[model samples]
Target chain A: MSTRRLFERETFLAPLLLSPVAVYMVLMVGFPFAMAFVYSFSNVTVGNPDFHMTGFGNFTAVLGDPVFRKSLLNTFIFTFISIGLVLILSNMLSELLTRQFRAKWLIRFLIMMPWTAPIALGTIGYLWFLDSVFSPLDWLLRTWGLLGKPHALLGPMSNMYWLGQPGLAMASVILVHVWRLLPLATMIRIAGMNSIPREIIEAAQVDGAGYYRRLFHIVLPLLLPVISVTVLFSTLFTFTDMTVVWVLTKGGPPDHSTQVLASFAFLKGIQGGDLAQGAAISLFFFPVLAGVAAVVLRIAKKAVVT
Target chain B: MANVQLIGIKKHFGGVKAVDGIDLEIKDGEFLALLGPSGSGKTTLMRLVAGLEEPTGGRIVIDGADVNDLAPRERGIAMVFQSYALYPHKTVFGNISFPLSVEKMPKAEMQKKAEWAAGLLGIGHLLDRMPSQISGGERQRVAIARALVRKPKVLLMDEPLSNLDAKVRHTAREELKLFQREINVTTIYVTHDQAEAMGLGDRIAVMHDGTIRQIGTPEAIYHDPANTFVAGFVGIPPMNFLEREGVVIGFRPEALLPAEAVPAEESMRLRFIVERVEDLGSHRLVYGTIGGTKVIANLFFRTPIAEGEERDFAVSNRDLRRFDLRTGERVRP
Candidate 1:
């Protein structure tokens, strides 16, 4: 009958607690997603969003193009390479951080700096760090006489043109993204490592299992469920990511070498003003991410045990 | 099997001395129970012997070999941790055979040894099951079996039976005593339970404040304690203390009984003011104050007693232990 009494009801309180998030998702995410789905099947342009039911015309046209094909292949290569490096580096870093040391607090704070800082802001900082003429990396190489020297390993180029050459640009993009995503993966790994009981490690030692044996047989096997969950989340981030490609190379060097699905979709829809084609291009990423999300949820369930 | 001698062993975690200046020697094929309350360094001393904790100052000699710098695996020791610490990911067979696998024993020999160990513990049927699928008592047995599988020089048990139910613990205590005798390996078992120490140990070392207060056969330690700490620690309801002038005297609860029970030739009478009485299954614990100091009397049979009643109790002269009033150390006559 009154405000407080009305809120006391379980049915009323439950929906009230959920309404803000539900409303935001339906308006912001749900509306755009529905529009994209419709646009992908219709002929819609930026200048004239007058939609006509075209029935997969945009999808077939986009698929036939060579640039989109190259971008699609490039997306897989970029994602897989970056995630591989992230996995190895994060595992090593987690092991180092899990041990007790004098500098642990300082080291942990510095290790988590990238994740705590905004992704877009960090990428902008990298824009200068990997510039063509002014990159500190090339400056160091030149200062060491490695790049400008005639018989040097990098060879007679005064500058490496980090963002100009197709291969170098792709490499730069992959490395930059690896650096950005590493802190998150490493934190997950550290949390996983901490959850294992200390007595188990000591028991292995007393049982005559050496250091590496304990790690491989005891630590790693117990860490599998956690590692799988970390891998799943990392996969989703890399698969849907466009910011690194956009900020570092703009999917560029003319061959579309570093272009991924997310970046190319933005280029085609918003910048190239072919909204219908861009919508169709991005639709390709949905099924892959959905599959990954499903696996992650399943692993998350298993990871909760022990 | 080997004798373990810890000479002035000390383990300091920063400023906290978990185990400080302890000297103890356990003989080959002997079962020594380290008995103490928590923070008494009983567990820390066992961990030091297991090589799990590094000693700050001491030499650990196992069969004349200095093992202070050696890793636990290199020291030829096996331990059953308080939590059992079974490899959750491994099956019972895998858990038992892990050490053999580390030794690089032949696959057939390793499996045979593992099966033998499991069978000895009556857990052969659970070999295919993972640790999570087993009950707590079975898990404890599996841990013990894993430790015994390798037949190391010394076996250290850190409250291994503490996790089991009361009925299971009692059965485990009996089985463990039998297992130790059969194996005839030197053992150092750490526990806070006096009953466990009394039941399973050939010798019980009572510890307090990082140092061993007394070490002797269970009968000797109980009958003749080195100090007040041991006398008070190793008995249920502990020993009662009464200070008079400069002398501190302690007597066991069972030692103080009705005047008719004590022998007349060595009798000392005291006026006891009864405050409460607790009826245990086989005994009645009489609570009272003798000359304003609290004392308990464990009476095995029913007696005519009431609260707030003045009663005369007797203690035999031989049963009373004398101590130094200032330091609480036993002062023998």
Candidate 2:
């Protein structure tokens, strides 16, 4: 009787069940954020190991560097382009994946390979693919007379120098990011597509709406909410991620052409021994992301089934 | 308006046959109800006609044209799903105008036609409301309005009213009947409810296990069933049967009456033992055994017999139906 009464206490059981998550949040998330906040406001470095309050110093130092500015610009360019491609490719893929096909399991598994495999492993694999001289992609272009040979397809050029060139390196980084993020977005979209009733789609077919008409008018409108969520998550992951850029380019050629805010911050704080500046640079995206998050939330709410 | 013909239509899902060898001809502007229990291929047959599913064999011809290769849009058809399937994101006006927009109709003309369709359904006042903002009944009208906006060759509906409350369904049924008459469009309505079929169908096709058992007017189907399945499926508490002499004798519960109440010149009498009675307000259901065969007698008038009593009951000669015991086919008298 005593144990039954104890178990019946809603007030006690609810908090008890939630304690582990609460503990994890405080220790894992809250503590790190608090430390970063303090470090951003103070002058702390790996060399000195001292906390001296110097408000705006780290922020000013980061803002003044041309490399920091270039990285800030690069981050936006990479994220937006990658997200744009991810949206288009993933939407088309989700549409195709939702329909019946032969060996669909293999296609889905292959599409998900980029995401399921370790990020470092995938990026390392890309290194061989984008190698300046030995890349099979360059070899294919050469065989097609597009990379080298006089008066070829893209004007005579030896090796194509994929990672060696500024423009090509940035493009390569964005493509890698798109490839990494696409499967997750496609899966989310497929789930959204499935949630719509089959009868509703059939109703559209009978109502004289053809394939394109149904896609634009009916399917896309209903999937708007889920798509917004997918875009938001992918945006956050891409904006704050350094893995792909780090492994493939490492902000190479000393020009910081493919440098993003996250990679730049890692370079400064963890590698360059300027812990204070790195924390400040890392926190730079907080306000921008927060603004984006607010807009997406509003859009998602409106897209919800009324 | 157009006529639809299904010539030996069959649909097989792997090893399972959802519809098998169904050949039905729907007259121009006629409302035909495909009636059957669930998994009886009524909906599958309807889908085949709508060009939603391609049959494993046979052809579907609408308005005298074979629509084997035609898409649903090219065939000119519309459907109201059981859920009413309104675009939750679009307002009623947007939904009604969607099909017209597909044709790239002039915006002004599209708006006018949509308003006209909405007016036909008396949903003109709800033009601006989103589907999620409307009631279930209103959403159904919007779905119908959308279907009608295009003025398609045929209209197909799958249990459109089964989602409504009982009180709402009655009025909606009345409205739907009136709307169908006013439009005079060829329609195929699929439903499992016999009452809905009887209320709406110009002719009802009763189906079972993938093949149609019978197709006729409500009066004909109720009065003359082709087989035991139709006889057993068409009515509530169904037709009671007693097997005797390699023949199955079936009669409606209402036909089984007290000996004195059945004033027919020739009647079959049975020694009935009362088990229990259910007072259904409008009628009493007499649950009892007749010649050791469990039977139900629907009596409009109260009887004096109580539980544990044995009495004489009779079925009028005209009301008795006989079927072959082995085949369950009605044996011609």
Candidate 3:
């Protein structure tokens, strides 16, 4: 009876030990999601400040807003370009550095520095480099005759607003996101490359596979999980990120031209006096990111089996 | 099948020599095993022959043609890795067909060859299954099938049966031997298991510290081991080693028996205090000590030797393998 009690005590203590983490998750993650869901149904504007229930009104208001529609389109455009570039460039660089050579650690360290740098600081640096006048980039380009004269890249050049024009603004944001995200993707890909058994590669070599044959048939297929996870994370970050846009354009020269969902939400609730709509706009990003994550997770799982 | 020759092959990893100066002549259609413990350079030697690794020095000739600059595929050889190295994402059919596909054989011909190899390995029924779905022995068969489908001049297998269960490894060993005989390809196999090496190799090259200690038939390697290492390494429970006054004496456990059974001139009586006795169904193993040296002797059936019992043991001169105590080499006549 005492032995049975001892066994019961041991098993009972397992869940008891886990209760702290479970409580923390419920309070932090579950409560916020519940609050967000509740806020989605309220007509809680910032100035009026009344948390009165309003069934789906804020969502319908967002769907009707031109600003919200533009933000949605810009987010998709930024994510598509940035994630695509990150996947391709990171995979290529990782494959190159996977080979044994002199100074490999040094090369890896240099490449990974961008990822280790603070994002706010990196974006600030980008802002300085792309400054319209007295920019080193502009000076170098003008000296090479690539551009007409010493001018800020943010200015209107041939009816194109690099920071305000819809297409160019999206492109600027996408390029910055890719630059910042490349190091992470490259590191993950390198890790994936390292995990592949040496015997497998040797087997392929002994089987008569040349470099390209080995890369395409063996390496790429094995690296799919890393690639998928990287693409998923970058997609989420690029779609919702406002740091680079905020630092460079402040969401725009002409009122909110570069506003993505995140910056738009900030503008609406804090500056424009619509808390309920802002909450709804912030929540708009959830489904899209969740869907992409789900698909990538499925792909990653399938890749692990191979 | 083609004969292979390695002339002064060497490889160094930083400051360490993995395959120190070594040469081997492998004849056509012969099954040879590179037998050694881990880090003894057997696998490294096999890789050099397969062209999976570049030799730091020397030349490799296959079928009278120098293949030093040739890649593995170009050398007309195939290797089965210790891990099986099957494409886990590929089906059994696809795994076997990889070499043929790599060679750019016609699709129909590749399929035919894969099917033939699968049939030969008795795995035709599992052609559509992935490598993960199969047992270790089945995966081993698939790896062998992949190598066979290539129709290479030589086959290199590195510790192929080490991953399987004991019974499975035993069964696979026989099947591997049968397949090698039927194919009659010049094969170089590497293994740490001396039993597998003895059972499979037509000629076994025993290696130590990146060099070949001896190369001979299995019976010769066992009965007349070149040095102390082979004598101690070749048998189950290994040969019992004893040293006295610069003379290293060794003999198999079965060779030692009760003194009354043998003629007095052919045997020497030694006294030992029993430490333990174990009954292992078909035989018994006695653990004891003689003149401060521990000794193990096997008996045909369960015997009446008890713990702490003292007894007279006789070892025949013909069965003893004597080596120099100082040098650890065979005391050659």
Candidate 4:
């Protein structure tokens, strides 16, 4: 009888318990998405409070611009390269971290320091570190005879214009993004590694699997779903990210080489005062991101460990 | 086939001695069961033999070569874990073919070997199915197939049938013994179930407190246990140890008989006050007290005995075993 009463209370109170989170989602996420949808279809701007519906005009204008096209491509390249590097480096580091070692907490803290720092602050620090004239990187490279003068095997060296050149600036942004995402990915991979049964690893060893064989066959295959999740999260974060590129290069170095969709949207919408085109530009992220997420989630489901 | 020799092998985890110094030899193609209760270091000893754990002290010799420095892969051994440890992501075929692929065996040869092993284990029809899609018994067969596919010199099994239901476990045990016989691989099987060890092992090593108390054939271990531990461990209802003067008298439940069934001159007789009788289909268990010691008798009769009735129970002198009171070691009369 008490259990039945508890059940009745649970049934009665479940929705009441859930309503706050539901309402919060509606206010925080749903409302913004709906507003963005409406703004994408209308010519809304800061100057004019009243606006009329526009039929694909903003999209057409945004897509017609070569800079917008370049931004789209840059966003894809940056997200892919950064996530790829994060996956590889974090997998290696997570494997090492999972092993028994002394001073492990210190190593973990050092690796996590960049991720724990505010992005803008960390990127600003990178900006100074990669400064062309007075960069510590340049100083180290010069000391190693890889910059500032000709050396054996290495061609004549000079100060690398890290953010001054288009290619170098893009690489720099991707590197920083990889550095920022690595700690989280490594943590996730470590959890995945720990979740695997120790008996399975021992069985593999007794079955005569060498180090690489055990890793690729047993460990990697079992960790597929977790790896997919890490990739999906990092990809989403890097794809729409504007902070690192904004603080480091601000989509500059001429010809808009390092510009990505999010930065491009911000530049045109808020700074350039072309709010309609910017809303349309940012809306482009939706379908592509959704498609990628769908594909990855399907893979994750298929590879889920039983 | 290879003989395995352990020479003072020891493993210490920090300060805990998981496996202390031990020495034993396993003849080629022998099925030796490491029987012990939990935390008795039987599994740790098996792991040390498989090269899963490094020994802190002595050497493990396989086929006359010391394998102390060899990696598990280099040791040429295969193990089936208690959980079965089937690769969940892989199909039955893929799981069985894992070791072959590691060796870079030709695809056709690997397929044949895997299929042959699956056929041997009677899981040939389920080769394409994922491990999760199969039943517990089928997964057990798949684990066996995977281990046997490599045809390693030595096989280690850590309670392989422990995860199966009782009904499946019996059948799996029968199949495992038959499979081991056919393969003739030197096998070390670890189990806490004395029934499993007795049914399958050629010789059973009863381990306790990080050391082997006795190693012998099932009959030898049962009829002439080296110590009180073995006598207590090997039987189902367990041997009853009644405190006597300088020693403890041990006797099986089956050794007790009705007073009238035994001659008065040949057997020791005791007065028992019947407390309860348990009907177990083919047999009945009579629980009673003799003097101050509680004693149970296995009676193969359906006749219900009244509770609180005093009766005489007789145990043959030949069936009685004695153990030292202090050391728990067996004492010959």
Q: When only chain A is evaluated, what TM-score does every model earn? A: 0.93, 0.93, 0.84, 0.92
Candidate structures ordered by DockQ, highest first = 4, 2, 1, 3
- Candidate 3 residue pairs in backbone clash: A132-A151, A132-A152
**Overall lDDT per candidate, in order of appearance:** 0.90, 0.90, 0.85, 0.90
TM-score of each: 0.94, 0.92, 0.83, 0.91
The alpha-carbon RMSD over the true interface for every model, in angstroms, is 2.0, 1.6, 1.5, 1.1
lDDT of 2 by residue, A1-306 (tens): 597787789987899899999999999999988888889989899989677999998898889999999999999998999999999999899988988999999999999999788988999888999998789898999888886888888658778778998999999888888889999999999999989988888888887788888988899889988989988998999999899999999987569989999999999999998888889998888898998899899999988463
> What TM-score should be assigned to candidate 2?
0.92
CA error at residue B10 for candidate 2, angstroms:
0.7
TM-score of 3: 0.83
Model 4 residue B272 lDDT? 79
Candidate closer to the true structure by DockQ (higher is better), 1 or 4: 4
Off by over 4 Å in 4: A1-57, A142-161, B302-305
Writing each residue's lDDT as its tens digit, candidate 3 over A198-252 gives: 8888888888889888888888888888778888888878888988888878777
1 versus 2: better DockQ goes to: 2
